[model samples]
Target: MIRTPASRRHGFSLVELMVSVVIGLLALLFALRMVGGAEQTRRSALGGSDEMQNGMVALFSLGNDARSAGYGLNDPIIAGCNTQFSDTKGYQLAPATRGTTDVTPLAPVVIEAHGANPDRVTFYAGTSIGGTPTLRLTSDAAAGATQFDVDRIVYGFNQGDVLVVAPEQPGGDCLLVQRSDSDPTATRVTVAADAGMRFNGGTPTATFKGYAARVFDLGPVGSLAFRSWSVADGYLQLQATGPDDASAQPSTVAEDIVSIKAQYGFDTRTGSAFQPQNGLQVNQWSAAMIDADGSGTAGDAADWQHIAAVRLAVVARSKAVERPAAGAACTTTTAQPVVFADAAPVGVAAVPTTVNVAVTGDPVDWRCYRYRAFETVVTLRNAGWRPNP
Candidate 1:
């Protein structure tokens, strides 16, 4: 082999090697930046999808229950009574009250306002197919009486049927009991605290004195719909008093629900003597019932009866907490969510409302999470079918 000149045998120089290493580092840095951006976009998309899903589910579930309100509770005499009940399975209902006193009238739907916090909405309905015909008590039912004597034989009632023993007046207290024995042609119905009946064994907080009372059938115990909806621990929860529920404790309906706001759509029109006309058109929207009849009292039975529809809004927050650059404030959420943002219906009077998302003792600020709001106006069809007082 002939010996070649060293100058002819060329190889990479140190400068060239350094330049190549620098180019490789630049490419890696660009790739890393692209990956980071893609990951952020993916996370945002996922968070938004999750929020939408949760909000829709919350709205649908609430609307479905609201539509069924007053199904078997359309009788005006018991529409706004403070109902008392006992359940051995730890089931309890929020008592109806106007102020500090126990003048809370039972209604198909009752909204408990909590200022800027989430509101609680309770719905009452029955599954009776008999259409809310009152069964008059032929005799007075004394306190602790287990049986009720009606004028005629109980035809549609069955064992385990829930009944509301209400006074003839609208504002009196009512008793809720489950029928322990059913006889088709019997004039007397028994509500004894028998075994296997969860709603009949516990002692009621108040004694029931039903004189000239009327019994409103709420269908079978398992079919009754007495549910309350509220938001707690960033979740939409439901507490059901119906015997069909597996547990008396509140169950989580959806996650990431931050707030719930509701308003009653009332038909304020009245006829002669200041009687409610029960019109179909809603004229006012309010969180609580107003004295529509100038009766000097708010949230009376007439006010509750005038509620033609319910307007609801629910806010859902993204699960991921977006972080900001070092020493900078988060830009993910700049303002609190709003409800009733648009102008009220053409003839309705109302104002917009804001929701508070801040939670105490939370490690991350609520502003770091994105939010979505779902809203709907549900007409209470059963309102039109309510029997006259």
Candidate 2:
């Protein structure tokens, strides 16, 4: 082979070759770093979006149910009665308790507070075509009676309409019955134990009986809503009761919801004695309904009637699992998320409340993820329309 001149050399020496190799390796390393950083940034952005979307869904579901609370059950005579209801298909209303007594009060909204843990909210409403009118019973309805004789002709009630037979007294057990047969021109609405009926069997007639009983129509079974909301297994869920949803299984409303906190907004004045105030404005908020009427029992009808609105807060977490560098500890979540930031007390001075979100019990380390909180105050419109008893 002919020897090439130094200036026109075709091949590089070993030193030049090594230097070229070093430069190529540096360029490759730099490109890899850029790609890695971009991936991390993308993950964070997507995670934040997911968190926000989930939180909004949870807030909307809770607010929607709360808005319709106490629709047909807003009557002062039956609004806060401990309703005795049952479904043959294993459906039962949300179990509420005051002290040691188990009760299920008929209200537009009931909040079961669990300190530091997620709270449970139950909503009740009727979708009757006609307005909620408490029809007087023409005669006494003996225990276990299948038919109810009303003062006026039952025109708007359908065959599957759910009716609540409430005693004239304010604090009594209300019975839920289904209208199996109804004639538009007749005053007798039958709640017979038909095979297709779901809420007529388990409730004993002795559970409700009186000449002063009033019938409140809850519309058709398909339109009746008795839904309860809670956070469980890292998801927001709704447990609804009706003919179609007799299973009573809680369906997931949103994912990554780690906590739910709620409080009852009362329409009372600022004083030692909780005096009723004018208008539908919320004067005070409490985690639980106390014996506002000095009735000796907490969460009684007297306490529930004061509830004018519900303040709800939901917490959501990111799905992305961040990794620590080498042996470093997780620094993604420096502190727990705060909720109800603007929730200062109104009227009187009260202790500020803080909720501790328990997000560490899951299989994966929750510290590697970020969190967001959504809050709303839903007014009970039906409560506003009803005059305080």
Measured against the true structure, the TM-scores of the candidates, in listed sequence, are 0.92, 0.89
Best by lDDT: 1
Per-residue lDDT for 172-268 in model 1, tens only? 6788888888678998889898886677765554333445588878887777788889999899998886655536678898999999999888877
293-354 in candidate 2: lDDT tens per residue? 55677777766777878888888988787898888888888777666556434543332345
Clashing pairs in 2: 70-108, 144-205
Off by over 4 Å in 1: 1-10, 202-211, 243-246, 271-278
Candidate 2, superposed: residue stretches over 4 Å from native: 1-10, 205-210, 242-246, 269-278, 344-361, 387-389
Q: Name every residue pair that clashes in candidate 1.
A: 80-106, 81-106, 96-104, 97-104
